[model samples]
Target: MHLNNDHLISLAETFKLLGDPTRLAILVACLEQEKTVGQIVSDTGASQSLVSHHLRLLRGARLIQPRRDGRHIYYHAHDQHIRCTLQDMIEHIQEEER
Candidate 1:
């Protein structure tokens, strides 16, 4: 598969987004189920503002989807590809710890 310049740039940008620990944690938090910003903040032990910031970035990247229910917004992995990629990375890291 030959990636043209645009595709290559997009791929690089995706990785750059994923390279942030807070953003990665936010994505992982959404792996199993949708979560509210408050839930993510509690789970990740990150500040509410920080989590919200990363959530915006992830949503913009299309790596996550947000649904509004009343005043609350719930976020989840946008597709199985994202879930599988994160799961694979988690498993690989666990293996490395052994």
Candidate 2:
């Protein structure tokens, strides 16, 4: 069966979003706790610029959401759906390895 153009584009974007280690790490970090950009940098051990860049992509994808407090912005996973999806992907890979 052939997929529609919109579906293909979405799949491509998902691939692109998951292709970068930083983006994956950012998602994982957000899963752990809602965090500000500085906190994310500390958790991921990535540069502030790098963390922000990944956060931008994840935010763009609607995989994560941000909360604003005073002058600081905090981010967290948009919902359990993404966390569950990531866990399912991990399990699928582990099953293949075993």
Q: Please report the candidate that would top lDDT against the real structure.
A: 1
lDDT of 1 by residue, 1-95 (tens): 99999999998999999999999999999999999999999999999999989998998989999999999999999999999998998999999
Q: Give the poorly placed runs of model 2, Cα more than 4 Å off.
A: 1-3, 94-98
RMSD of 2: 2.2
What ranges in model 1 sit over 4 Å off?
Answer: none
TM-score of each: 0.94, 0.83
Pairs clashing within candidate 1: none
Candidate 1 minimal-lDDT segment of 10 residues: 52-61
lDDT of 2 by residue, 33-91 (tens): 78999888998899999898888888888998999999999999888888899878878
Clashing pairs in 2: none
Q: What is the lDDT of residue 36 in candidate 2?
A: 94
lDDT of each: 0.94, 0.88
Instruction: Please give the RMSD to the true structure for each candidate, in Å.
Output: 0.9, 2.2
